[model samples]
Target: DGVGLMTAADVSAYAHADDGGVEAFVTAGVDVRGWAARPGEGAAGVQDPGTINVVVAVPAALTDAALVNAVATATEAKVQALVEGGYDCSGTPTDAVCVVADAPGPHREAHAFAGPRSLWGARLARAVHRAVLQAVVIADRDGPAVRGQA
Candidate 1:
């Protein structure tokens, strides 16, 4: 249930895009509904506590080669830009972001899912990891009878 809200797949998927549009699309999904976007402007350092949330979606089932290539492509300028632009966090400012993708279907060519670091990327990753685990417990508790429905 909560895992749905903590999906990092998008960041991973777009990180590998050849044209480099992940930040734009991601910012749109993660920002105020009526907000605007500025080139080189990412939500790297900014965070909203409590009710805060991030949404990441990406494609899945990619070949090892493709993923390696995608990582090479995403690592250079994408991660560098944030580092240069003054992203900050307990982790490298770039650690707030993480990408994940899954491939499931009859058949298709392989694709890669890549995620670059976020400003607070590392922190977000850690938090999500823990939150996801708890969500599983919560789901089970509510399932049959663990006495939890909150």
Candidate 2:
């Protein structure tokens, strides 16, 4: 299993945004664990043991519905990453995601909206994508057996 943590500050540095969306900062962390499946088996054929979780800290400007949408966007991005990496998650993966608003900041200004198509949501997706990719790399390096004998 591999775990990756990314803070809003980290994203800010990575995106090189003037504010990194710091005013409405969102932090996303991802844990990705992999399991081996029988050879030649498709996604449904594997008894997958992989799991994914996303935790987020958002600014107060975000709404409850927006929070929920953010979770969905993160989840979709995680699954997309896993699939792109050739993991069969159809049978044996669990994905859990949660989002919480931060205390009122100096701005205290609410966002117009949030969702996968929204700017904030896109940022959240990018953060999650990087984290999950990091975890996968770690898993690959540490455990050759987990992904099937080399």
Best by TM-score: 2
Report clash pairs, candidate 2.
none
For each candidate in turn, give its C-alpha RMSD to the true structure in angstroms.
Answer: 16.6, 9.1
Worst 10 residues of 1 by lDDT: 27-36
Give the deviation of candidate 1 from the true structure as CA RMSD. Answer: 16.6
* Model 1: lDDT of residue 55: 34
Number of the predicted model whose lDDT against the real structure is largest: 2
lDDT (CA) per prediction: 0.31, 0.49
Residue-pair clashes per candidate = 18, 0
- What lDDT tens digits, residue by residue, belong to model 2 across residues 38-122? 3664546543344444555554467666767777776776666666655544212344556555544577755645566687777
Alpha-carbon runs more than 4 Å astray in model 1 = 1-56, 68-74, 83-97, 112-150
TM for candidate 2 is: 0.55
Give lDDT tens digits, candidate 1, residues 79-137. 33322322221112222333343454577655533333532222223333333333223
